[model samples]
Target chain A: MTSARSNNTRLLTVFTILSVLFMIGWWQETDVSIVRADESDIGFRVNPVIPTNQEEKNASWFRLNLKSGDTQPLQMNVTNTLKKDITMKCVPTVAVTNPIGQVLYNQMTPKRDDTLQMDFTKIGPRPFTFKIPAGKTMVVTQVIKVPKTNFNGAVFGGFVFYSNDVNAAHQQSASSSKRGVSMFNQYQIVVATVLNINKAAEVTPDLRIDRVTPMAYRGNPAVTAQFHNTKPAVIEGQQMSFNARVYYRGGKKVLFRNVTNQMNFAPNSTIDYVISWGNTRMQPGNYTLRTKVTTGGAGPSWNLVKNFTITGNQADKLNKGTKRADYSWLIIFLIIAGLMLVAILIAWVYRAGKRSSVKNAGH
Target chain B: MKKSWSTALSVAALALVAAPVFGNVASVQAAGPKSGDAALSGVGYANTNGASGWPAAGVEPQTASGTSVAGIGFVAGDLTLNQVPVFDFGVHNIGSSETFSMQPVDSAFRPQKLSGNPITADTKANAGVRALVVTDSRAQMTQTAGYQVILQFSPLQSAKVNDSGQFLDAKGSATTDPTKFTYNTGTDNKPVTMSGASLQFSSASVNPSTDWNAFIGDSLDFGDKAAIYPAIYTNSGKSGPVPAGSMYTTQTRLAAKDAPAAVGTSIDEGKAQVIYRANMKTGFGTWAYDFTAPSSVTMKIPSANQQTGTWVSQLTWVLVDDPTQDHANPIISQLEQ
Candidate 1:
């Protein structure tokens, strides 16, 4: 009976040990799985993120018919919205596409956003795509510039944003006042106007010198001249530069005591300005004036030059001749008498030379 | 009989000494599992290159693939302050004690660290651990997902009146104001809203009796909730005066060039204490803070237009996130008194 009791006790102990081992193993496996499951959750998820798009603002594009080599610029705006545990980055790029889906201009690096001077003659109409990630939005655009020389094939280019870890994955967090789930998947484009210059400066607008008058002054004199911009279009913000050279008989600039302001003029605009030798006595003699005006934005497309002269008034002779020259009948009679005297001198000189030649022939 | 008892006792002692030898004596084993974890400093340092101080100029958000875009709220209207606050935060697996460490990531920025590593208590997941984050602006108690975050206030280096006005020790005492600092955090992982936010100084070197120039550094944890929407962090409840503490009474930094009759209520009132950057003069030690809002959210104060005054404002700051790190949460900076 004792041996049987001992056997029963050993059997019970063995069963208890097995049961405990099984439970422990089961618990460990369960724990491992739960822990691992949480880790797996950290992996990637296609959480519906916001999208980045093109910026749309009314930008005026200048349309000019020309060969090619012209390009213009447009800008887009970008914004970002994301919460904690997520960082966002952005890389902006720009590409111009034709109606047939061909890229004209491709730029990805951050560019200076100062207005892009565009030349539409070279570049043609093209669409742009801006692709960016979660953290930020961008304003990407293109500028059209008319190259000095024209090209055969039309090229269009715009700016866009690409993606990168810097602007996305480790997105900088937003402040509470501005915080929110940052708008994700950003993309946008801004459309702007393009200006085109198709013609040369000379034929486009020429400044014709009507007259240069040296007015009598108490001391100094004034040079009055006019300019005109004949082209149908109004030149915006055009600056004209000119050099004035005055001379007496010889080609020399007058030593004017004072000059006011740089020669300023507008396209198709005319004005009268002065060049005075302030309060100083003037040197009386035949004087000539030379003036030149530079074309503005349409550089070289509007270079202008004009030269003319004004006879100097004689000092004492001016007073003696003034009365007679001023008297209506005296002025007319002097003009007629001078012509008659010239005619009589020609007749007498012709007869006298003829008689001398006749006497030589007789001898 | 007593002698026999003594002999038995001697025999018993010998048996006790040799008991281990007779038993299936084996080599000593580890008390617990073989955990291969590194110890974590209550504070850790990280290199903050492109991620610290100010956002890179024209830095838009980007994606992991370096292809997509992410968004950040507008802080400095034109330029983003890509200032990444470096933090020593990671699991100390082996000696995985919950601890806090506050040392300067950059000495010129601030000086101090909290206890870190060797956790005060081990919590499997949602258990709470208290953490203090010292920034330039206000001090805050945060109830994070599994821990509590307390931001320590650093003295600002820019101020017209009291360049050292914001200088307080780790305990948050001041020379001009008697401070009373309180916490609105749950003992555990519950949201401690503003209502429970109270502050007072244990002691002050300032004259609190005659002049009431008390100042409190308050912070708001725009944690999971209110992460996106605009909310007001104030001194009093939602509508009370900005609880300027004694600073309001002392009114050291005049609200206006000329004093306002009602203090912050007149034409020169700041609505809330603030300093615009364009208005900042270099070398002026001002109040600074790091007002961290998760997921790149925006923060604003009440009054007319209260912003979560950040580093740029010289009021608050933020630490940048580096996804390459363990938890990637940067320690933000703000004021320097």
Candidate 2:
């Protein structure tokens, strides 16, 4: 009984001590991906979210189609596979480069934690140099500023991953010699920006005239033409000077009559161009005014014309064509007496045409 | 055995009188109701259903048979066993626009929890994130665009206990608004104007990205690598010398020969000027944290020797011969020691 009791006490004591030690070790460790003195998680956490694009290989960098107008700070996961206590900085950068080390855009990037700004350049293996702690993982992230160009395709940049897994790094590192650290083993994240983008060429603009009705007022004629620019972009995007000329049918060839006017076409705009056969530009006569507008480089020429006849002698414009007398009285007197004669003539014509065909058949 | 017997007897009596406490209470709950009848078979029979309930918070039971599957949440072994501490964060394309929002995986950093922490939402906190910039390539026109986001985080910095005896520097509460999000419209709002950020919400205007997901970052110091900086789309109908409004609007790099001069300096090469202010009262030197994992408390190794030299974002290392030997060279010291 004594022996059994002592054995029980010793077993319980050893077990209790072991339990306490386990608890202490658990409580004291700071495994960055797995845990810490207070936190047990410290090493790599390959987030359960599956890789979306085919370019997303094992331990490769990727481009998130994350576009935001807001400039707020953001945090992302540096998802890993290892479950060791580790702490790493998650940093973000917009590549001014491609995977093959071609410098696409070179800008000075600012450091996330410090006041330092990183100027991008070609290093040995990685695209950019970043710091990762021993036994800790680093998360690369940044608050994507809303870019001016909202792109439709994927961005081609290099996501250079670096680790202190090299022998030199391990030998030089002073932090946590006991925590078996995997000297920095790194590979560049050849992030193939897979994007589903849609784009369309802008619509071609053409001028359509609503109406070119020619009208006469006080023995003077004028032609009005409506013009419009139906495009999304501003038509007057470039500074353009303009001029136009008017022409008329002078017997055979068309004649030019300059319209003293200058105007602009706003992008997708509609405006009216009016040309008059008034005394200043033309005399009171039967004439056609053809208007021609010239715009700056590469623009199609505009040619439009309308004809109007002046009537009555109101002196504003002389009716150059033969003027008609007041013939309403003569026409009215004749129509009063012609109803019977018209009926007899119609009967005769019908009989005569039938007789001619019959005579030809008999012959 | 006597002590355990007395404790079990005491627990048995307490079961009749009061609540359970101390020494594997979960096990006691798992042991099931007493196998005897109370009140001489007149009182209530054994309450076998008690074992079917959920374990109390922070309690651990060895077996799962007694508890219902629905009642038991998966328990994790502590972090000491290389189970949960290693953390890695990155910007991954979770398919497309269908996914992307602020979500922190750790229990401590969930968006809702960060929103409630006592924080100093200052320029330093803002430094952790960068604005998106124009990423359109050279073409007659940059149509159909997309942006590249770079995430950064440096090692943590230890804040000294302040005058009030509180280890306070900057703490903050974070809230996210996924709306007010847009891409390159080629108008007043430009993506190129918003890349490589170092400051977070020191301003009331800064908001999270539209297609943002949860990322890990420091609550106090913005790592030279920690900020969540967004960038311009590939090509969305706008290019030809990144619009003057881009964040890298003015990007001029020092030549290879001139790079050494920029080793310890923070210079501005872009028009979006960012200023960094020191919090020290008296004269102070510029300071950066040593990114490293701490050792166990054996008390045998010297603390000065426990530093991991600084590397540029897990890439290049600018290390000393020995972290423990700050100024002393071991080669030279062998002659003197």
Candidate 3:
């Protein structure tokens, strides 16, 4: 009975220790600060040409459904509250996925991407110009004609409004014997317009995971997967989870592990998704990378396990970049404490057994 | 005893293995699914480049002028009026002198008898206007005291012309037939003898007791009136008040010598708007002492025999900004302010 009682006490002690350790691990504080983007500097605002309804005053983007050879006229209103008259110009641009897995509107100027088939000029208002008097409003219109040929998926572009005042001021200064460069504040307001042509055509979501590269993301060294959303259909609401484990060419021990989630790809674009690896050094060796992605709703899930070698020079170059991560020291301490508790359990068993035999002999 | 210890060890091991799973669960929750119409609208900056033409010179002061196009970049400095106010005193009996006064039309304050809707420079999209906007992007504007906006008009003129444009006569000689009437010039196609037409302005009759609405820095007292004198440019190209419809340029800067009654003031900043009450004038063609006679902007034919034909005049507005220190090209200072 006494042995059983001592055994219960010992077990209780072990459980109590385990609970305390777990509580300590959960109690550690994590530093996080979230700041929203600022919008005070934006000079002007853009709305869809046709308002969805009177209740919803300004629609942000155009969602058009059309067939081949269909012609639609797009109209929008621009207002200038500045004291001076403002001349506005419009241009076409495409959406590009940046390294951080976010969609960014690229202003098409000097260079045009070849993969983009939608022509902004064919839609009528490539370089539209209008002047809005101070505290006045001006309305502009553009007509779009879809090609007769059948095409699936969505074509994305934007009517980017730029100002001419800066250029005019620059010209005036250059001709009028001014010694210093005339500084001009310039801006662009982009109204995204998406055209979905032909319901009969196929709009597939074709994604290709090219390679896993190491790069710096937001001042942190991260492992990124370079991929392309080749299809015209935009892939959104994606619940993607990537697990990257680093190990030697023929070793069982993993040197580092990285995981990332909630990644999306823009329509007909290429992107790089950075994996979060907390404070792990890049070592020179052969490595095997595994990734698993499950998209939202009736979509196919991906599991790819691949091997890639990291040369000495590559590791050295990557190590020089800035990497931000938090090392969990509490985890290490808990792990060591667990081991010690296991050793104590073994010792308690031996002592209990000895005590039990001695008690039986005395009885 | 051994079994219990084994169970406890297993539980601890499971917990050790599940630590990473907790992080994964948090991430999954944070990245909730989002689909359908992948459209996004955000505030973006616009920058374009082009040249705009100035308004064309008019044939006569009373004639409608062409649209004046001004280009504004990110930082804009200008003083603009929504539109000009026209006072039309309809036809009256002959040999009788009629008098009228003019006051501003604002939503907050309404005139007892306004002829028609005041002309606004802005289109239908934006129809509200209260004060002038004066922008200064230079770094020095912040260090110095703010600027003021003054308004002055030329004396009633028989007729005149300037390099900027032409001015129509305030009154013309009478004609036997109204249908054959001509403005400024006579129906005989010649300059008519002056009918001794006259225009007098009283200081702006602002309600000093009325709290400042939009004007930022200027101090005004209750029932305060800003003086408006008959200052006109002479026929020989000098600044002076003339007998007939003379030439007077409302000084763009309120601080200039012959300041017009200040309608607004702008402080040293991006959007510092000062508001003032619209001026009031009596039916006798003089600035009203108060709002007693149903203050209305009236035009009077003082001499019934003056003109059987229609007479016209013009008011031109100039809006420009330059850094005080930049004298070489006062018009075109740095674009980015």
* DockQ per candidate, 2 decimals: 0.01, 0.02, 0.01
For residues A154-268, what per-residue lDDT tens digits would candidate 1 score against the true structure? Answer: 2122222222232333223311112111111111111212122454222233355555555422122345444343332222221334445555656554554222211222223
Off by over 4 Å in 1: A1-203, A214-220, A231-240, A251-253, A257-265, A282-285, A292-363, B1-337
DockQ (model 3, Cα): 0.01
- Using lDDT as the measure, the top candidate is 3
Error of 3 at A275 (Å): 3.5
Cα lDDT computed for each candidate against the true fold: 0.26, 0.26, 0.39
The DockQ-based CAPRI class assigned to model 1 is incorrect
TM-score, per-candidate, Cα-based: 0.19, 0.18, 0.37
Residue B262, candidate 1: how far off, in angstroms?
A: 43
Candidate 3 lDDT by residue in tens digits, A233-323 = 6654424434556556677886656554444455677765545343465666766666565665676566666676667776666555424
User: Cα deviation in Å at residue B230, candidate 2?
Assistant: 40
lDDT tens digits by residue: candidate 2, A57-171: 3211232333323222222223222333232322223233111111212222532212111111211112233332332222233222434333333222222322333312222
What digit string (tens of lDDT, one per residue) describes model 1 on residues B1-337? Answer: 9999999999999888656433211100101101111211011001112221111323211110122112411110111121223222211232222121222223233211112344221111110111112111111111110111111122211111123323232355532111212112356744232110111111101112211112111113212111111011111111212121111111122122111010010001111111111111110111112223221112211121211111111112211111111111111111110
Model 2 lDDT, residue B44, Cα: 10
